[model samples]
Target: MRPTKGKLLGILAATFVGQMALQVGVIQDYWKKNYWSGQGFAESLSPDQTLLQLFGFREFLAGILWVRADSFFDEGNYDAVLPIIRLCTILDPKQIDIYATGMWHIAYNFTDEEQRSDRRYIPSALALGKEGSRQNPNTYELFFETGWIWYHKIDDDYHQSIKWFRQAQERVDMLPARRNLLANAYQRNNQVKEGLEHYWKLYAETAEQYEKQKDIYQLFQQKETLEQNLDTMIVRMVQRGWLAQERGEAGQRVYDTTEPFDVGFSARVIVDEPKVLRVQGTWNVLPVGTRIRIIVRDADNPNFTLAAMDWDGQNEVVLDPERDATFMQDQGFVKNRRFNKRIDMSKDPTMYPFARKSENYLVEFYYNPRSASLHVQDKFGWNGEGMTDKNFLRTDVRKEFEWIPGPKAGMFTEDWKLAERPTPPARIVYTALTLSRDQILRKGDWIDKTPMVQTSNFDASRFSVTTEDIIDVPTLRSSAPSPIAPGEVKKTGDNP
Candidate 1:
């Protein structure tokens, strides 16, 4: 078995080549499974051609195209840059910034060039973003970009925006900016509960991140500021009845649903003057032929109904002192008339004598279907003592009215204020405790001395309240009474 030197050398070379081949095969398999999963590889490229075979060069090509696209963007050649960006995506679909920039250019920059009127650009950007997300399904940034385009560029459709943003939110790599955007979208769309939930989530996440940092003084200051902001948001939401607490509830209820049935009762005081108190809003999603009553009353004398009329849910109702004759024969008696009257408060001295007096008034809107009922009452007051004549009384009384939804519809009430003051509930305390824990020791030694938390998280589904929760929270109440002249009293009470 004594071989020659050349034969032995050949044998050794063959064994080394075989080992190298095996190692190469193992590496290729790993790359295929991990790096190139769900991605197309150029089959024609040779294994030995490292530059063409690797993913890095594709990224480099994309970068080059990105620079070129930027130049085209600077030149205001939006359409021209799109094709270049498209090619870049093909070269490296996983590049998140490429998709974000391309979508932004089409959605915002290009649309701005056309004064936001061209609807074509929005869909184009959305399509590009979706394609990018399709190629890189694991990335959150691409999904966030799609949501941003839908929210800001498209027709302000928060529903569609939230759909994509939620997808981004599900990813663990979600940024604070993305979370803030999602919260803003929810709030804008009147999904207050969901918005508050996300805000609290953000607050917790931020606190957790801050605790991990080494700086002590900066952390304390930041923590204080963040806690204050969260408290303010909680108070505002509770005061507005966006989040309400019930006696048996585990947590406050979030008015998160957007169904018209959920928003069935809404009203605004369009005009509040001495002569007339006009209220206008919608009673959406009520059953067909539902009876809605519009009632105006003197705030001083709640018993006296200034004006009352019944309306079917088919059309909008407008109650004006000047236009009542169209529906009435005498002052208070409503004749069998079907006049479609519009709301206009023109100066007609003979028609609206109540408009001349400077006093407080109450407008109530009552919705009572056989199955469901709702009431929204508003109070508006005026100080007319200083004004010499009724003509001098200001007619521009555009006070905002507080529209409270009924308890049967799952709306919250003023009870949240009481639940939060002096001591916040267990849920809020839990949040503070969790956030205050030190990252190193995982201990909350300073928890007891922590500032009283203003917000809490309760199980909204556990809320069970009776009709008693439906309290009449007045919009405006005057402490002083205005002295009325003898002649003015008759005019204010008399029918139009």
Candidate 2:
């Protein structure tokens, strides 16, 4: 059959347009690899997905996978979502939410029988965030997430968190609230001098924002918080410096080894109703905002926590949703050196099945100085340097603390003399208490009406002085403005 010339021309035009679109997609992908996402397609994508990506279908495919991941999450299929999350991020690397939410799932979703997070996955979560930051160098949210994980989840590694928060603040689009976290990390890391300086800057910035937008309540609130934090830090700095100077003049180190604050950790359990109990405790710290982490779970159940971060899409996803049948957890904050919390495991049978009534339960109480507030850290150091617990005091070697420069004289006159001696070593000192099922449930022969008290008596012999006990404080800025008022202050160690 003879075809018309016009029909043949139309066919040629359609073919040309299709070829141009394909070429444009390829060019766009090339630009994305070199400049946008900072990775090649072959490194992260499967061969089939690579082909799809070349056709500009990466975002679409990533969206579809994200939807599937959400579905899996809703169905309690947490393990299945990891590979999907990985692929989605690789496919559309610019999507920040995937990195944030995916890291959260990996770090927190994998739980044990007692609902304790499988902490082994934390490093993998950190790796994911680091990779995300590499891909999105201009964005601050991923950097902040990385800092948050270190600050909260990675055992309160404030020194590590400071690194990421510093980077996050470098970005121009950083949020004002997130900017304050940098100060918090500094404070927690025992770099109170740096923290105060940062707080002053943030306070001034927020004050400007308040002047510009008087109608916005958040700006005013932020300004107030910064002001309060600055004031508190100043007071603590003055108090600590005075104490240090007094000790030094008495031929002692900056921190006295002879006198240690006794943390009399005690607990009481009162049964309010079936499966409901009031847990109260007192610790001998005169600071507010300290908290104790509490965990109540079946004692006999073995920890069946999986530690793999299988984002390669080749590994099988296996999880047992029934592991958390009897798990309960809470944190009680201290007010006036006392903490009380009520736990009601009566609701949501699916979440708290309490299926193993015959088996004993374990109630765990723990307090870490690294996770405590700055005021607490000021008195106790970052590692319980001035604290003693007779019953639950435990010590272990940790490698997190690093040496920081001693404070030089600046706004305050006392810091220079106090900084002459070394700071306390960030020794891993902690207090912990565990209650058996009989003790908490009032079952078997352990029934008692009196509150259970675990007093830590001081033993002077235990704290013998040693030359190797010297520790380092946080890095102090060479010069800082006075927190009381805005004025140029002399640099530390300057000639008067």
Query: Could you say which candidate leads in lDDT?
Result: 2
Off by over 4 Å in 2: 1-55, 209-217, 239-259, 264-367, 373-383, 389-396, 400-423, 430-496
What would the per-residue lDDT of candidate 2 be over residues 336-380, giving only the tens digit for each residue?
A: 345667776655455455566545555666666767765666676
Computed on alpha carbons, the lDDT of every model, listed in order, comes to 0.42, 0.61
lDDT of 1 by residue, 154-271 (tens): 4233455665677677677876555667766665444546767876777787678777974756555655655675676576554434344323332444332211122223333333
Candidate 2, run of 10 with poorest lDDT: 304-313
- How many backbone overlaps does candidate 1 show? 6
RMSD of 1: 25.1
How well does candidate 1 match the true structure in TM-score terms?
0.40
